[model samples]
Target: MIDARGPEFAQVLERCTVLLGTLFQTRNDILVFPGVGTGGLEAAVVNTLSPGDPILVATSGVFGDRFARLAEAFGVDVRRLSIPRGRAVEPEQLQEALEENSDVLAVLLTHSEPSTGVTNPLAELAPLVRERGHLLIVDAVSALGAVPAQTDELGLDVVIGGSQRAWHMEPGLVMLSVSERAWDASKRARLPRFYWDWRHAKNTPDRFLAPYMPALGLFYPLENGLHEIDEEGLPRVWERHRRLGAFVRAGVIARGLQLFADPAYASNTLTTFKVPDDLDAGALRERLAETHGVLLGEGQAELAGRLLRIAHLGYTSEDEMRSTLDAIQLAIAAERADDPT
Candidate 1:
């Protein structure tokens, strides 16, 4: 207990959190909470929005819909713009939505579309939201630390990310950066909150972390992860993720599979592929893991049995991706031979 709140540890935590913000180039203050990325999602909502505030959700896939549902649970007036599962929400589309929803208080968007493997245009969409004078909140649970997110430059009001994805930490830690505009919104926000309160400890003079029980152990690993990212250099890390994404896409294409998401907006952390004709998605994944020891991402609700996903992020090398590709190829070949048709 003392270790978690001591001045030395507090300084270390502050340094690490700030480093995480640097990865996004944000100058905003950060709030570290104990929970999953969903907690950060809720915090972003409750901390800055009243129950009746009309907010727009730009959704394309499973996680995006999940966030919209979370907002609905909080009683927010959620208006969702549903893009097709494999495509991104363009800036023009957002502009049109905002124009139509003149009373929109904020726009909730997922930075990296993990379920469908599309990376929404954050850099472009930022100005669009700013131009319309609405707050911007992003779910970057699987995007941060592996992709480019210029929080300050993009003028995002609240940016939410998790420790598990690119930080490679065990789950239950969610990080948030709240801009000044969001802080102002918090003061007027009417949503009920206690443990998720952002102002209590965040602005306190000597507070080490949050005002409540914190995920104390994650701070140490978070510091180490930030150090690793710093040592590797951000640009190099970003480039590595890009190359890995391309490699996986090429691998799937060489296997005669179609990519689910448009290549122009594909995410660097994950890639989605359409289920091959007459092939069972789940069985294909099972055969890959059982016979070749290669594990692939399972599909979400509607996408289930219709597509498969390949996900990788942080510290992964080319050889590992090659291994995954080889395993998938062999699995497919076996599945084909077994089927009579």
Candidate 2:
């Protein structure tokens, strides 16, 4: 392992942060943490809000619910505006919720709902929150590089991302792009924090060093991944994901499977579909993995055994996606032949 405190490492980190800003389309300060995406969510909560501070959480799927639950755990008064599974959170709905809860200090929104493969309209929703003088914290863990999130243009306060998502890196690092307003809010906010404190993690002494040792091993890979993203170009990357999403959705539909996410707001990174009522979702997934060497994500919580998610994100090629779709078709056909209604 390289010296984490050395200047060489610092340079690598600084470059990664700059690339991260490019990915988020923000010139704001980007903070890196040595944990998973959920840790970034926790950091966003504790850094900007005090205990009992009311906030509106717009939830469209499992990840959204998790963020609301996380805020509740921090003693933040969470007013959850839940949308139906597979449906994006409408701007009108958020406007109404904000009007109803005028005392809310901030708005927690999931940019891309991974569980249901729905991508919320951040451009439409950001103005509603910002116009009301509320902080906008976005969970863009799965959406960052794959989707277009103009953080600076949207005036989002805090946007969280993960290294493992669109970057195709390992799961040891999380990033948060914090706006100037968010930094000011952190000064007055009072909620217990030690490890996740942005103050402690901020670059110090012009050396780009953190108070504590970060995920050293992840830094190199993170830098390399960011460079790869830079080489590909962000706009082109987004277009690729968009095309992949459309291709997967069309393939699924041709196979007679209904999509779980609204067609208008479907995610570019992943596609969720309903499992036929007669077939066991778990067994079908098993058959796909064991026989076809393809693994699929299972539905979470109440939707378990009813939906399956296919991811087309992170360095995946169209050929790979086509093969995955073919595998799904074969697996479903085999399962049906074995248990005919």
* Candidate number achieving the greatest TM-score relative to the actual structure: 2
Clashes in predicted model 2? 0
Q: Give one digit per residue, the lDDT tens place, for model 1 in 1-341.
A: 45665677678767876787787678788788888898899898888889888999999888899999999999999999999889999988988888889799999999998888999988888898888889999998888989987888889989998888755677777888899999999999999998788875483335555556567787788888888888888899899999999998988898888999999999989888998888899899999888887778878888888888888788878899889878877887889899958
User: Which runs in model 1 stand beyond 4 Å of their true positions?
Assistant: 201-206
Which tens-of-lDDT digit does each residue in 128-228 have in candidate 2? 99999999999999888888889999999999999887565898888999999999999999999999999877764476874478778887788888888
Off by over 4 Å in 2: none
Per-candidate TM-scores read 0.96, 0.98
Position 301, candidate 2: lDDT: 92
Once model 1 is optimally superposed onto the true structure by TM-score, how far is the C-alpha of residue 290 displaced, in angstroms?
1.9
How accurate locally is residue 273 in candidate 2, as Cα lDDT from 0 to 100? 95
Compared to the true structure, candidate 1 yields what TM-score?
A: 0.96
